[model samples]
Target: MKTKKILIVGTGETADLAYEYFTYDSEYEVCGFCVNRQYIKENQKCGLNITAIEDIEDKYDKEKYHLFVAIASSKLNYDRTKVYNELKNKGWKFASYISSKAFVWHNAQIGENCFILENNTIQPFTKVGNNVTMWSSNHLGHRSVIKDNCFITSHVVISGFCEIGENTFIGVNSTIADNIKIAKDNFIAMSAVVNKNTEENGLYTGNPAKKAGISAKEYFGVL
Candidate 1:
């Protein structure tokens, strides 16, 4: 079978990282980069000429090329999710990059456009939904469900049977206790330890994580 070609969508550092990882570590070949017209700063990125997203499908031919949106966890990952949804609705195929060093159990299910990086452990029966990003050295415990568009930062621990809601951002070194349900749009701050179920748009912080009076959107300036 011919190796699939991929276009990384972004001109930022994440796109460069994706290019390196996909080129040397995965089966997909990184052909070029794409971004919205207003954000184009340079003509090229990673030695490939950058293409405006407006003209991407015609130039790349989606039938023969897959896309990987390299946007990071901005606005609780709403920005990345929007890009993913727009491309998917337009009939674009996506490519996921699970690092060769990540430990994803055979029984685990991960959806499209996910970026699972090195040393992450996705245990048995764990379900990761579309457009998710699991950064380095995180532990997604058994039977846990991480919903769509969620971003799990480095060194995080999501204990067994927990449910992470959609568009949530779990910060670096945070720990979600077993059986916990983190609500949608939650922003768990760095090193927070959540032992109880969270509320929608919650802002959690501290060792024994406590929800702040303000919503996650307000804290992140999304509102």
Candidate 2:
């Protein structure tokens, strides 16, 4: 089989890790990096030229290489979602990077442009939606649904039958009990333990988590 070439659409820390994962673990060879023209300071990155998005197509045709948006979970993953959708609408293809060491059930359904890292246990009948990022060592329980553009950080434990809403960010070491439904655009802060259903845009924290005074949108300055 021919190894696919990939162009990462950021020059940040996430992108650096993505390049390493894709290059070493996956069948994709990262040929270069791309970012908005204003942010281009270096002539090259990781021994490849950093091309501006404005000139990307002319230099590296989309037909030959796919893209991966490697931005972190800033603004509850709004920025990454925007870039992924924008690129898709413009006819640029995307590539998902799932780590080799991750344990995924046979019946699990994962979608496009996902970045799944090592030790993630995506259990039976799980549905992971498009453009989701599951960082290292998360336990996604059976029949759980992770919606599009959500970010699940490392070492989190999401129990069975849970539904994580779109544009949500589950922070590092968080725990969601069984049957919990985290609402859209919400932020579950680091190590928070959520046992009940969350409201849309709610900021949840603490054990048996309660909604904070400020909305998740307000806390992230996304609106």
Candidate 3:
């Protein structure tokens, strides 16, 4: 089978990692890197030439090459989400990557522009939304719903029947108990344990995951 050519949008570490993973493990061939002209600091990244995002369609031809926005959560996850939406509006198709080493149940559903890394287990009946990122070694329990534009770091455990809201960032080593509903735009700090429903735009920290005085505004400069 002929591998489809893909252009990853970003020139940072995440883009480099995406290039390596797509090159070796997936049926996609990464041909180049891209970022906004203002963000381009180098001519080359991961051994590939970086193209200005404004000129991406002219150079790569959206019909011929798919795109994967390899940008991490920035500005409360709005940065990556905005880029994804813009490229999508321009008629570019985003690639959804599920590493072969990841264990995703047959009944699980994943949306476009998602990146599921190695050692991740997405149990049956789970629903992962678009532009989501699941780092390595995480366990997504059965019947859980991870909304769009969320980022889940490594070693996080989400028990069954949980609902992680859109644009939420769950840090490493966090444990979300079953039936918990994490509200939108909340930040779950490392080593936190969520046992109950969260408020929207809440900043949670510590073992029992109490609301921190630091608001989401502190992290994103906006609510």
Candidate 4:
């Protein structure tokens, strides 16, 4: 089989990690890096030439190479989502990667441009939406719905029948009990135990998660 050439779009730590993973584990070849011109401090990243996103199609033929936008969940995921949407509008073919070490149930449905890392177990009937990132060692229970552009960090436990809303960020070690409904634009802190529904654009923390009087924008800063 021919290896798929990939252009990772970003210059941050997440982009570096994506280069490592796709280069070492997956069949995709890391061709180069892409970033907005204003943020291009260096001409290279990960030993590959960095190109402006505006000149992406001109430099790399989209038909021959796939694109993966490796951005962290900044500004409650709006930053990543913006780049993703921009590339999508330009009719770029986005690449999604699921680790071979992950145990995703055959019945589970995962959407496009997602990054499902190692040691993650996604149960049956689970639906993971587009541009979602599930880091290593997480448990996504059966019948759960993780909406678009959400980022779930390491070691989080999301129980069965739970609904995680769009563009939310669930911090490392957080736990969501079964049947809980987490609303849109939420920032759930580390080690939070959410037993009930959450309000939209809220910040939640502690064990038995309660809304911390701060908006997701206030907690995550400007997009």
Candidate 5:
């Protein structure tokens, strides 16, 4: 078996959780951690040296280490996405982290840099695109399509064949009906039940989810 060295970016709760998960798996050897300069209060995390992103490739060779950005918030995820994209452009590879406890179907197609947390049930033929984050216990129904850079919170239920567009954030406990089309940059608030198609950049909420605002950018930062 080939051993892979990994560099986890960030030292927050989510990053620590990821470190624990990957280290116990044995296949991945966590080399160290890397965070933005502003977030690096100390020089180490979990007893391993924590370097800034600017100095990471120097110590761990961009081609030799797999980088995983473990920031949790939606806005931070967006910022991390930009930083990762810049790294990718410089020929550095990024890695995805799928929890061993997650139930992912064999036929599911998950794109690069995705993070699927514990208890996620990704059914057969589901297509999940790059930089997506699916929090714990979410049910991604069969044949569902989740596009790039989306943040799906815990307990969300996406029915079969539903399409979640780019840069959208699906809040906790939300349920999207089967075959529904959620357009780009939308925000579906917590506990909402989406029964119909949504327009691009819309903000939706409530039990059958109606359009609540123009776009999430009006409230949250721009995607």
Candidate 6:
């Protein structure tokens, strides 16, 4: 197989983790790092040159580089998704990272640009959509569906048959009850317990998680 050149589109902790994960195997050859102009602090990152995303092809061929947006957190994840989609439209291939330490079942489906961290347990028949981020040590129950651009923090327990919607964020140590449907753009705060169906764009929290606000956009800005 041909060696694939990859560009990690961040220089943060998550980007470093992704770099280490992708470069470990012979399949990928990491070319460099790319970030928005404002975030560029150093000329080089992790021993690779850091370039602005707009000048990616000026330094490297766009067709020859696979891009991975490595930003964590829901708001930033959504922002990164937008950037990835724009670059994808301009003909860049997106890369996903599935840690070697993660335990993913054979029947599970993971979409493009997803990052499944170490020790994650993705049970059978689970479906994770595009640009989703699953942090370390989360348990994704059997047949659960996590929709596009969702950010799942570490130690989350998503029960079987649960459906998490687009642009939502499941905070750390949260528990979603079996068969629950969390609607689009919702935010489930840390340590909350979700038992019932949530409305679109709702912000839920507490044990048996109740609607805390109308939507996350009020706090995080529009996705």
User: What does the lDDT come to for candidate 6?
Assistant: 0.86
Candidate 1 local accuracy as lDDT? 0.93
Residues 1-223, candidate 6, lDDT per residue (tens digit)?
Answer: 4378888988998899888888883366888999988889999987889999878878887777888888777462577778778887888888778987899999999988888889999999999998899989999999999999999999999999999998898889999999999888888889999989989878888997888745677777774
Candidate 4 is scored at a TM of 0.96
Candidate-wise lDDT, in order: 0.93, 0.94, 0.91, 0.93, 0.85, 0.86
Each prediction's TM-score versus the true structure: 0.97, 0.97, 0.95, 0.96, 0.93, 0.91
Task: Give the distance in Å from residue 96's predicted Cα in candidate 2 to where it truly belongs.
Answer: 0.7
Candidate 6, 83: how far from true, in Å?
1.2
Lowest summed lDDT over 10 consecutive residues: which window, candidate 4? 214-223
Stretches off by above 4 angstroms in model 4 are none
Looking at candidate 5, what is the lDDT of residue 85?
82
State the TM-score for model 3. 0.95
Candidate 3, 73: how far from true, in Å?
1.8
Better of 2 and 5 by TM-score: 2
What is the per-residue lDDT of model 2 for residues 1-223, given as tens digits with 9 covering 90 to 100?
Answer: 3389999999999999998999889999899999989999998999998999889889988799999999989988999998888889989988999898999999999998999999999999999999999999999999999999999999999999999999999999999999999999999999999999999999999997989999999999997
Off by over 4 Å in 3: none
lDDT of 5 by residue, 52-91 (tens): 8888767877768888777765562467578668777878
- Selected candidate, larger TM-score, 1 vs 4: 1
Which residue ranges in model 5 land beyond 4 Å of their true spot? none
Ranking by TM-score: 1, 2, 4, 3, 5, 6
User: Between the candidate structures 1 and 3, which one is better when assessed by TM-score?
Assistant: 1
- Model 3 lDDT, full chain set: 0.91
Instruction: Estimate candidate 2's alpha-carbon lDDT, on a 0 to 1 scale.
Output: 0.94
Candidate with top lDDT is: 2
